[model samples]
Target: MAMQGTLLEFILGWLMIPWRIFVEIYRHAFPPANEAGEHEHEGMLDASSGDITIDKRELSHWTKLSQQWWDPEGDFALLHGFNHCRIPMILDAYSKYIAQKPLPDTNPLRGAKIIDVGCGAGFVSEPLREYGADITGVDMVPAVIELAKAHWNERHPTEIGPDYLCTSVEEISSQRPEEFDMVLCLEVLDHVANWKEFAAQSCRLLRPGGCAIFSTINRTLAALIIAIIGGEHLLRIVPMDTHHLRKFIKPSEVEYELNKHGLVQVNLTGCTPVDPWARRPRWSDVSYCGVTYAITAVKRA
Candidate 1:
């Protein structure tokens, strides 16, 4: 009887395993409506060509990757994370840097020119306009640029249109070289296929003494587990392929590339992790915030 009971218990446990896995997947994929709905916005349409403009062949793959990284509600979530319900953390950091002193009379825009590369949804760039900065925001995705335009329009109803362009960094640099006082490529370097080349192109766009800020995940074991396994498979918080380990760059590696392109790192900061348990932001270094790293660099003369 003891042997028979043991066998039955083993069988029961084996049978329940699949159900447990299914339940876990369901919970992660579909969080409670109340929680998910909190991020939802009223119906907004893309003003740039109602249809997405990338080539059809590349559209599927780009869209798949984009669906993961480009959260339709990222602006809303970022506002909640950074203690400022108005702008993104990156922009908040820049604004804080500029607001340190009074703006110079000769130069407007907080005494600096700014360019926000990969300005997804204009979360970071829009705030700069209020400070009187000549900010230009660029992104490759038409759908995303459209969304950013719509958001910009809604926010600045009385102001002139945003200086937003849709193209790769290299393409833009080829057309207009040495133009910006400062360039921002936050959280976007890892997404591109050839970051070294892209970084070089980004450098060419900057004027002497101009600054370019960047943020991305560093390639490491912790990054892979948190960004891919936990973020995509477990949490279902971001679409799969949002972070490709092979494309991720280490801090030293980025510094080398920037140095090669005549840019030098001025500052570096570790970001606080996003708390899944609390469903909010928290100050931690456990790679819980998907191992993201932020860097500020200046162009060589």
Candidate 2:
């Protein structure tokens, strides 16, 4: 049996070679092309074609990893684990702001319109749809957007799937002002050159009473050590250069941006594992050790 299993593994490994070669050849031949083509937009921060705020290096890095975006056990494994703590916080903040108890597990977000900026391959968008939100996921990479659309079709080809667009928040907001009730622009702050201006666009995309939840590493000594040194350099949980130390936004900066955009900050939480030794899932944490944090803000009615 052991020999049989080893033989099977060997055969499978050999079988993957041609497919891998084919994929490489295809990617090189039909490369994702220009960064400008990655996003379709004409609005604030980028009022014309070829003017988006995305960091070219960052977009390229993400585009290179587009194939792994939906694989929970792949390059985004840590982020996949991080979402266990994040999703609940988003649900709780939205429920509390409306003076309602948590919605039931089944389709809790029914009848809500949601926008997820930088939603690469729909890991967040897919689950949110299960909870019943009409989700519109936007990203600025053609390869990434194509992967997301393919994932959705393979997973739910006929259902009312989330609308995934290859665009930026500025363009989307210009096209559909005051359309969404909630925006989940989580973990996307550190990748853009115009984060503040883009944040204001998130506010502009929401209805009067809508809310947005943003998450990213705080720009601090702690984050420099943990997020950059430990995670990126030593562990390589994400691609090298995927995060820039200087681009990490401070919590206060997030507050200022939200407030400046006519949105009031409501909740800020440090997310960490409840217990580490037991290989436990993460939980909401109040301590601001500065590795990763999230902010929830609301647009006043």
Candidate 3:
């Protein structure tokens, strides 16, 4: 059995060679939109001012997944399990760095004002609400925003959960600058056409000394193999076109953007699966940040 398993692994590895070569050829032929200077005009909603960051392709892609957003055993199963790692990180960061106090056993995040940008179907928002945080969940996709609202209403009929909004982060930042105590922008950086602007607006939403947390895939060969090829194609864990290789932002890029926006980098942690089959993520060291990682930054007071 062991020999057979090894042979199977070897065969699979060999089979992936062609796919890998194809990916490299495609990458060289058509570089990242930003690198190729396509962002000069492409993905711009308004050519006059060029302030909008909504990628229509990304928006349409997510809209197709709106109905499956809440399905745990469906395409978003990984995201559902990912809450276990991210929620704790949020709570700990707020308590240690922001509040500078011990978290209460119950209602740990009471009185905390948080905004969940790119919040799909209120998955993260609902958990934060249970921990007593006042959350406002926002998404560019109208269908998912409505789905988030409907789900939140169904689950918490009497108690008000997160306030769901179908709006871009740029618009929200302009409307309510420096209003939130914490900003949660998980798994969003890679999807935006203008990640720098998207990140800037996310940081702008935070009050002085407020924390902004972000999670995204690193732009690396490992990420291409695992995230794009293995996860999307072989395992079929997520839908194809869910992620683009060129759009994956490096951790250094994230840190630079935060620092440029007057936010200091606080924490950077790598997240990896517990096992080959498990969806549960375990926190790893920075060296393992090739696949997925999370960043925590605080606005300078």
The 0-to-1 C-alpha lDDT of every candidate, in the order given, reads: 0.59, 0.73, 0.81
List the pairs of residues colliding in candidate 1.
109-132
Native RMSD of candidate 1 (Å): 12.6
* Candidates, ranked, lDDT: 3, 2, 1
Q: Return the candidate ranking by TM-score, descending.
A: 3, 2, 1
lDDT of 2 by residue, 1-301 (tens): 0011245545654455455445434543464444233343222134354335566666778888888877755677666666687777767876887436768767888888889998888878878887888899999899988998888789887887888999877788889988988888888987875687678777889898888899888877677666655454444455555665556778899999888878898888888756432222345566673878888888988
Clashes of 1: 1
Error of 3 at 280 (Å): 6.7
lDDT of 1 by residue, 1-301 (tens): 0011245545654455455445544644564453243113111112143222222323344444443232434313422343232134334444445444544443246545677877765766776776667788888777777777777787777786558887767667778788887778776776654466667787888887777777788777677666656554554444434555655678888889888988888767666645544333443333233377767777777
Cα-based RMSD of the predictions, in order?
Answer: 12.6, 9.7, 4.4
Q: How many steric overlaps does candidate 2 have?
A: 0
lDDT of 3 at 133: 95
Q: TM-scores, in order shown?
A: 0.67, 0.80, 0.88
Q: Is candidate 1 or candidate 2 better by lDDT?
A: 2
